[model samples]
Target chain A: MIDVRKALFGYSEWRWIFFFNKESWLSRKSKNGWVHKKRHSGKSGMALLLGPLFRSQNAPDPPPPPPTPPPELVWEDEV
Target chain B: MNRQLNEINLLRAIACIAVVVTHSITNYAKTYEPALFDQDKFITYFRFALLWATPVFVMISEVLISKNYPNGVRKGFLLKRVKYILVPYILIGLLKSYMHSEGQWSVFFQRSWEIVVLGHWHGFFVLVIFQFYILHILLGRFLQKSHPLPPILISFVLSFTYLYIHAGNKEYRVFIEQVYPFWDRTIFIGWLFYFVVAFYIGQNYERVLIFFTKHFYIPLITAVVSYVMMMNRVMDRVFVSVKSDRYDMLIFALSVFILALVLLRMIKKPNHTLIKLSHFSFFIYLTHQLTLPYLSNLTQTVANTFWSHVVILTFLGLATSIGWAMLFYESRLTKLFTGRIKALDQLAR
Candidate 1:
């Protein structure tokens, strides 16, 4: 029931992990090794793609996240 | 919390109360409202209101806790979090198992796993709390301690993504159908916006409070209007969007905001009892549904005079919920079970 596969960057437990303290930021991991995951496809940023729970097979199965709430932007354009 | 921000805890308690009722009234497993005068219709309006409670709680959580943490620390913070989360997680889980499992040793054993894996959200919100702790630590790092744009963007993008997914798949559609369905948690992407909003307000506590202060009447009027229309069957009469959780978020945010402002303005010094209410918010959340079977049975029994039953059921459910919460919290033995009763007792005093 478990797939041990981890996605390329954001989904990796280690990748994109941040230590925000200035000290940690200046450390070898944060200062030298950090790179923002970018989109080559037209899809949204990498954060949306990085759910490790969704990926895990043997891991405790979490219910899929709630459907996103819609916009309240009452644009002058959209009737 | 600053002087103005103190009452926000009251908002948290209020949100928790709304959630208590939300779960109480809407268990498809149990229907506790009376039938006449359209009980189903009343629940629809309630469905809309309940949609916002947990999210509002999450949003408030983000406000109070997310940005407050310093990013650079790792193991220490996570460990501290585990102490709060896991102790209760393990304890109440065992407690639920013991209470629910008379002789079903196998079932009792199964609940331990559920607690770890988050089987019943009705019984515990610790799962969501765990998710938020991780998000707060991780995203809190990327958030430049001041900008509001990130959450703004996160909110819109995730909303569109869900809509797109909603278009293609019925399975996805069914998952997010209800506001707080245990099977349909959308926290990962959906709550980012809320977290950001919470963080922004937490940071600019005064600005948001002031802005909310000035515009209080506007949202208040609109929410009342929407709620009245919802109850009157004026809006959405043509197409009832039971699964339309998005609007629930929109309206709930509005309601919570307006409610927050109104409560803030009215209470110069909140009753000490009200302050006491905030401490049991989590416990109250855990037990709101405990009275469901009693209320639901009572509802079905009084189905003849539906409106009167509705009134009685509402009052009884509310009282039973608060009473159960107080009893659980005040129990001397609860300290031994939750492990933090000692700690919480110290804080409460």
Candidate 2:
């Protein structure tokens, strides 16, 4: 009988998980298995305001540096 | 001492402390409104832990009534209770009305009316209990000697549904605003769940106690869990700018019952401190609100940090309330407020 009551009411404790920020780390299931999302830096201020609600799985790599302009077109010519 | 009665007294004592804790936090919060939702570590956790105070109180009342009148309520029982409960309520209500009202007769009349109907400050609970007591008598006729389980189950469903759909309804919200003196807490339908659950437990004490003892871990876990759940709701409401009523949450109502039982199990023999407080609990309730304004002043001047300020204010308010109650207890004024020369003497039994 006690087991019955526990089974019915005990799940309520799952709510305690909401208190911790540790659980805020997002993970998603993939073809292989669940994968933890790596947090990206330099989020816009508005994104910061939204906090854990808005999580991105992957950070966009830094834009490739513009080509070196063919060695500055024989540098002396440009100068 | 009867072990069960001692347990009841201890429950009362704990509930009284929780009430003081809740009011202390909130009274300060009224001035330091930011502290309650400030994400302050102490205030947030402390507030959630004691949030069950009011429901615990209502449950205790139901338990007492059910324990004493399990054979079904009678006219004599109602009369005795009414004389004790109603007389004190009226006397205190009149006193508050007199103290707070302006010189105008009309103002005095209006204030007195509000006092009786809505109760003077914390005295509103007396009205709630009075209504439930009368209902208990009427319900007894219908229930006869049947087991309390069926009604408990039925009322739980019905009351929770009533609260869920109607508690924060926009139309009634408009109505409450239109009538400024009206208090929504006086509505008995919104609080039926607490009374019903307690009544059932009181009626089936041995069985329920066994169940609680065997599954005590469940309540321990849920108490913490429910606090976290309540904090989430608080955050959600804050985020959305929606204000929820203090005692209207269904989950909160359920958790309080579970927590009250958990607390009851830990208390084997009632401590002297608890028994004394339980005796004077009502007196404390009647006087506590009067201390809030003064404590509000202290909130501004006493301490720099939110935590220290709240801590001092809580102690000061509780001490002052108890102080006044103690003064009244030894004075002739005790009879005026509580219908006895020594209020604690009668209650200690």
Compare the candidates by lDDT and give the number of the best one. 2
Local accuracy of candidate 1 as per-residue lDDT tens digits, B201-318: 6666667666767778766777777666544432334224433234335444645654675566567776555455566665555544556556767666655443454455555665
Docking class of 2: incorrect
Model 2 residue B280 lDDT score? 71
Would you list the C-alpha lDDT of every candidate in the order shown?
A: 0.53, 0.62
Stretches of candidate 2 off by over 4 Å are A1-79, B35-38, B144-150, B174-182, B238-248, B331-334, B339-343, B346-349
Clash pairs, model 2 backbone: none
Per model, the share of native interface contacts recovered reads 0.00, 0.00
DockQ of 1: 0.01
Tens digits of per-residue lDDT for model 2, B4-27: 777777777777777666666665
- The weakest ten consecutive residues by lDDT in model 2 chain B span B238-247
Candidate 2 displacement at residue B269 in angstroms: 4.4
- How high is the lDDT of residue B13 in model 1? 66
Q: Candidate 1 chain A — worst ten consecutive residues by lDDT sum?
A: A70-79
